[model samples]
Target: MPLDAESEAIGTLLLDRGILSPDQLLTAEDHARDWGVSLVKVLLSRRWITSDQLYEQLSYHYDLPLVDLMEHRPDDTLIRKYDPRMMNDRMTVPIKESDGVLTVATARPGPETLLYVRKTYGPRVHMVIASHFDLSWSLQRAFREQHSHEAVFALAEIDPEMSAQQVITPPQILVLYLLLSIFLLGIAFAPVPTLIVLNVLLTVFYTGNFLFKAVLVWVGGAAQESSSRAIAAEAGLLRDEDLPTYTVLVPMFREPEVLPILTQALRNLDYPLAKLDIKIVLEEGDHETIEAARSLNLEGVFEIIRVPASHPQTKPKACNFALRYSQGDFLVIFDAEDKPEPDQLKKVVAAFNQSPDNTACIQCRLNYYNARENWLTRMFTLDYSLWFDLMLPGLERLKVPIPLGGTSNHFRMDVLRELNAWDPFNVTEDADLGIRLTQKGYRVGVIDSTTFEEANVSIPNWIRQRSRWIKGYMQTFLVHSRRPIHLWRSIGPAGVFGFVFFIGGTFLSGLLNPVFWAVFAIWMIFGEDIISPYFPLPVLYLSMLNLLAGNALLIYLTMVAPFRRRWTYLAPWGVTVIGYWVLMTIASYKALSQLVFNPFYWEKTQHGLSKHTANEVAEASADVEEAKG
Candidate 1:
């Protein structure tokens, strides 16, 4: 096997066919002369051609020298003996009867194939020749024909909206109207107690919520950092050879502009091509994204699963459809705008192997890739960093249910399937599913893997996205809290407290912050005597302490987030985030209104307006090429 003349001749053929560049051929020859390595290895190490490309080119170049199944035609006697259907459907190679043995010629020889052959021929078989390429092709062709339905089902739609008539009511609007009417009527009366009651309620609600948030952050932040370090350590131990199969499901709809970046990011993952199951889930009606997918002509490993036309167009619905065809034991979801760490999947696998069997989900840290895109993105990234890199891990350590981010959630296939997948009807199905998982006695852990996603930097865009998220959280709250006993039983006392502090507290704070700020402003503008009699000394002291502590905690949380990310320069923006919270309050009100009106309407967030430099693009491209190869 000392560089067979035929193989050398095939290398020359590859050069002539432009499969290997002139420089690659020269490098291959240089490596052979200098290091005594095979030209194939040299070429591979130099990143000239992929193994699959080399195999394909070599097999086709030396067509006759390579195994040729056409030359050894099946005998007419054997053909007559076996049914035509069996010959067509079953993968078999004919062998001539020999002295107490039958010598067969097969295209591929692997453990699975050998098992089948042994089962069929009673273990009295001898192999004359084995060609891996031919066997792979035959197997792929057979599988393509027989199980293409997997692909079809992966693209099918599963949403069906039921039309039910009920009395329509505008609760948020009605509440606001009632408040306005009371205020107007109070003007005719003293109007002093009304203002006092309102101030007291706002102060109590915001202060309580803020204190709860601060406590959760303090507890969760340490655990999240520790979990991240653990994940990174585990990732370091994984060899390229031991990398497990990973399925990346990116569900898209009318997002043609981001497809290029999305696919490119997936292509950059530090995983084997054979082990990567990158499925771009698209809607049947989303012709724009479909066309974008087709134009990429991405490698055979990249597949476009077209989710058939469905009633309620939702991301989880598309994911549910694709879940059926996923062959990977570990599944990770990435949003259209996400750029996940190359070894994130490996980290997930390592974490899963180390964790208990009940740990069914691993949530990866998420940050904005375009952190400096604008003031909005910067603040959004800070908030997200604190939530994922701090709050989530703390909840996990506390054994409380963790509300999942929109993407970068790695799930165990068995548990995911058992849960009947994501609820198509729930807008924030991921958040809902997190609660459901805890109820079913499954725990979710956090991994250190970070997924950089596109933050909504524009004010209007941010509002729309934030509003939808708040609305979904509201829906999740209602769905779970409809039965208080069930919630207490499933989550236990600690979890119930955690949920109220984190989810309910966040919502209440968002809704009440403006009111508190207004009271402070009014009191500052008016004389102290106007407010002093109504607001007692104890009440005033408590409110002031709460406000001071809450503001300090907000600043601390925001500043600490950047430190965790190793981007300390971003800490200055903690002052700006206060204004951002005011904006969130506005969005929360809009979201609350929409919850009763348009619960299922998806608020579209636009992207690709960030000022990414050429260097960033080149670096991203290089990452993509490495991942894809």
Candidate 2:
């Protein structure tokens, strides 16, 4: 397609003024053509000149006065009159109205924008050039409250059943009451048989849990091997010009010190910088991190989205707020401490291409970079290796709903929007969204790529993070299980069983481990005579088998987890995972207490505590300085 007269004029003006060299101009033009973007965007994305210089040249070319939106803020009333989404999409905003004429601010002063402004905001509007950052910040300031409200309440209002706002519903409560009543009455009437039945049920549950996990490991081990290789080949073959724009959301809260590590990691991604739409999503109250972002003076492709201070100050809510401003065909969330493999995004793109049209998400594997740091870190790494590398693939192989990892899960923007994104009320919003996607007729695929994250070195910090995750799991199980028939119809019997063992059983096991251990200890200490009435021979034998075999199976699974990555040194640490489970039991209790008292509370996990991450942060900061110099 030929450029419009105004676009050609702007390009020519840049050359005449020596703002862009001839070779740079030619390269940018080719990129602009290939990327389906304007010459201004191509130049800006390349960082050939500062935004001020480009906007100033734009002001000169268009014979329009350049305005600083921050100094002369836009009118809230006038901005509210127009659709915010439309305004953001077009990168234009109505600044002020005076004497029947509206003064509008726009980053792009072109023919199309001129026509749109005239057609939408009346012909008497005056146009002014503003830098993209300034315009975006102004919009954020003007609509902060509205967007915040929407981010927190949109899912609840749009799909109440999927939201965790209500936590336990009326019907679920009634069912729980009925179960409790039955248990109490049975204990009151027939003690021995009731205890026997209870013992049998728990033993069966324990057996099924271990069996399900073993099955997952077996199936997941081989799942997608050929497909993953094919996807990697396709990813290698993908052309840069043909690559689509990808939005990366990095939501941070009070972790300014580690910002450089994340930024450096993102910069290392093997993708075209011009096509990366990276947003640093931060809370309005996090002044330190916000200031740190400004000090970096990142490229034009990186935008800092200042999320308004809102209740449920969660990463999901911040992501939801930033989602409104994101313009991409695909979107992904990365934590502040994440360092994904360079080809991870490309692999995700390829996976999506080969997947069914119903596929809405492609989850990548996750593990820790500081696996050898300590026992806790090693255990955490092994756990992640099992969950992401093994169990997730199993879920995919069986066509079950795969609960997403906290980060590195990519999504199709259209389906994400249609589903109202993540539920703000669910602390483990990623996991909940995965199940919700399956229920909504969308498939979630798992790829073989990995994202390395900082492992928790401190036990207290680990507990806080784990507790939040367990609480979120509880919320997901309760929310999905509310409509048993609906869930069954949506995900099928296989999925229901997976959900029970995977989601419900995760927290339940944590709570049940100590109880079983206590029972075993009592039997050993007091002998069989004290509790022989309650524990019959068959039930007692089954319980012992479940106790012994279940732990051994889990230990074997953990030992094998690190074999894929050839991190065999960490395999010996798997035997000591019993200590890790004890910590999980503590977290589970905390999670239960929080779920009962304060369900929506987000337990903030402090990062940059590990020695490895601290060293990386220092190195990253030095690299930033070198780049600047």
Number of the predicted model whose TM-score against the real structure is largest? 2
Clashes of each: 3, 0
Task: Score candidate 2 by lDDT.
Answer: 0.91
The runs of at least 3 residues in candidate 2 whose Cα sits more than 4 Å from the true structure, single-residue gaps closed, are 1-37, 46-48
Model 2 reaches what TM-score against the true structure?
0.95
lDDT of each: 0.69, 0.91
Clashing pairs in 2: none
Per-residue lDDT for 604 in model 2?
Answer: 96
Mind giving the per-residue lDDT tens digits that candidate 2 earns over 1-629? 44556656778999999888899788877777766667777777755788889899999988999998878878987888888878887899999999999999998888789999999988999999999899888778788888889899999998999999999999999999999999999999997889888888888899999999999999999987899899999999998767888999999999999899999999899987778889999988889999999898687889999888878888899999999888788999999999999999899999999999999999988999998888899999999999999999999999889889899999999999999999999999999999999999999999999999999999999999999999999999999998899999999999999999999999999998898888888889999897788788888787777878888999999999999889999899999989999999999999999999999999999999898876898899998888665
lDDT of 1 by residue, 303-354 (tens): 6776756545777777876675565778888988788888888788889878
